[model samples]
Target: MANTNWAGNIEYFPTDFHQPSSTEEVQDLVSRATSVKVIGTRHSFNHIGSPTEVFISSRNLSRVVSIDRIEGSVWVQAGITYGELSLVLDSEGLALKNMASLPHISVGGAIATATHGSGFQNQCLSSQALALKFVLADGSLLEVDKHADPELFQACVVHLGAIGALVEVKLALVPRFEIAQSVFLNVKFESAVNQLMEILSLGYSVSLFTQWKGDCLDQIWVKRLPSEPSPDRFLNGIGASKAQQKVHPILDVDPVNCTDQLDIPGPSFDRLPHFKFDFTPSHGEELQSEYLIPQPYAQDALRALHAHQSAFDKHLLISEIRTIAADSALMSPFCAVDAMGIHFTWKKDWHSVKAILPLVESVLSQYQPKPHWGKLWAMKPKQVAQSYPGLSEFKKTIQKYDPNKKFQNPFLKELFED
Candidate 1:
């Protein structure tokens, strides 16, 4: 039903939209179509999965297929969102290691793009997959996991919607745990950048939100275990003060949409992510872009961004910086090294955002930044190729799985060779 991405910057009006209720239906649709692409929540800022011949929506496919308590794993239909799965996991007294700021995204889509949560050690969501099930080009089911086919497993985990339509995801789980979220206001941007790694390590998951126009970082969100000690200040108790009240990541928005904060302990499902899943984001007004470079370069890379504070301030709504550990998935940006994610949420002025992106990329180019596959980036196809060394192998894996190329789309076609 929705033709555009959540940001509404790119309009994708597919010729055919099919909502398949079960794997059988998905297989039927795929077999009948000449070409196809699958869409989850349509949260992606890019046109990565926009289909030319057919569009398959995962809306009706949300369900839990099985659970393995002894093995600590769960098999969920591709359409189930992290939020929905969280509820099921909570009942089972299990939890995921991390979650993105927004839990509204479907599990398959999140893993496909290697979406990650903020933490010094947490890998992207794709790393949690024990196995994945896809309906391939010929309406035949194919499954891959670490044990079955390590190479193909690694390749398809973050397949970018190319290998096939991901029908199911088998995710690893942990015992459910409680976390307390705290916020610090007005941290000195310079000092914060200097001790970026230390700040990120303060919690199980942490995020830094900023408005580049100012000298201070807007907020530092820390999600720590209940037993962890709280800090009164940072930079020898001079840079920031604890937030007296809950605050939204954006400037002047209502904090009601945000999760509980100020040292309140809550279930992992509630505290790990920034917002509650029941409420969908108000959209069509913003666009986002992100880059992940090695963690060692974070401080210097951040300094390079400040030089364009004026440009960022004019077109930006908010920006966040987070850390991600290296993942085994071949195509993941953080595959080779631990990374620091620099994210930009720009106001819906695509013209200005478009014009200013080259400048942003130029500043970050020295760090060998890798763009978030789900978000916007100005890098040319060749530059993207250079950024991810695993692309060639990834291409080979997909080509093997979908020999007919029924799952291919224009976005993937540009970067990959036949």
Candidate 2:
């Protein structure tokens, strides 16, 4: 049987798909192969992690190396999932600063692709990275820290699995805390956009959801610290009311898999992410595309998406608006400053969706939206690179690390060449 990605959008036919339990085995594979890539959890929707010929999977490398309580950091194998890491951390009375909506993704995969969680102050998951151990093209293990090599580290953290195979990652940690999640309903789209920042600032982490076919938004999820006062009726002036029962991000779907809501307090790990650790995130059968635009142009981008409502309304299940603070990773969508992500979750129909992406791109073109590296997109490579200010430096760094191009896959070749 052929191996496929989590979304089943891409299938792999590699010369070998080796599962290496130790870094030495991974190095051996890299040293012997003409071309190779590192596949972690296979969460990526694109071909970034699937090398055409040879590739190594880190699934067997799942282990928690150590936790430095004094330094407030946790080191774990690259294949460890955030869900698994969180449980380990929580048991020790520690936690990550933030996490992506779905915790099923591997730590290395999420960091390499710049996956982020929601919050005006919380940076992308990669920002918490203190140091990393990766196997270089020469089959040598190299470790880099933020302090010793700022420039290379900045470029390396989000390497897109192009430079090397990450073996271990060290991340900053925080004292465990409690969080409460609440959902508000029926907020007018105009009002939400007009006070978008205000709404986002309502809680520690916030997410706004809508279908784009109506005049008002469908729901707004506000996740907050236990000490923060819960809003019984959020956006009241804008006609938003507290949801009577549990609700899914996309309307009418089962909320059983979602995390606790209704302002009930729970462990930060269980509350920060939208979905539960064991449950399938999103609809389990959908295609996703997201664009992170400059925060200042959020209103403009929202207006642009709203303009094409008729085209996407039928094919779209829902759209989510989330925020992330500025980060230093070169290729990260929010590298320069804080960013607003406009994400679309569509009904699994790529034909219709692909046709509309260009129009969606055209509308938000003025704002220079940076497409998520791991999701689906139709933007030209040049257009995609234009949004990242440090693309040139990132390219140079890639050349330095993988000069033999052993890690270069067709996706990276087109991305860097085009």
Error of 1 at 1 (Å): 1.3
TM-score on alpha carbons, each prediction: 0.97, 0.97
Q: What is the lDDT, from 0 to 100, of the residue 177 in candidate 1? A: 93
- Which ten residues in a row are the worst by lDDT in model 1? 229-238
lDDT of 1 by residue, 285-393 (tens): 8889999999989999999898778866889989999999997788999887999999999999888998999999999999989899999889886678556778788
What TM-score does candidate 1 reach? 0.97
Residue 29 error for model 1, in Å?
Answer: 1.2
lDDT of 2: 0.87
State candidate 2's TM-score: 0.97
Check candidate 2 and list the clashing pairs: none
Locate the minimum summed-lDDT window of 10 residues in model 2.
278-287
What CA RMSD would you report for each candidate? 1.3, 1.5
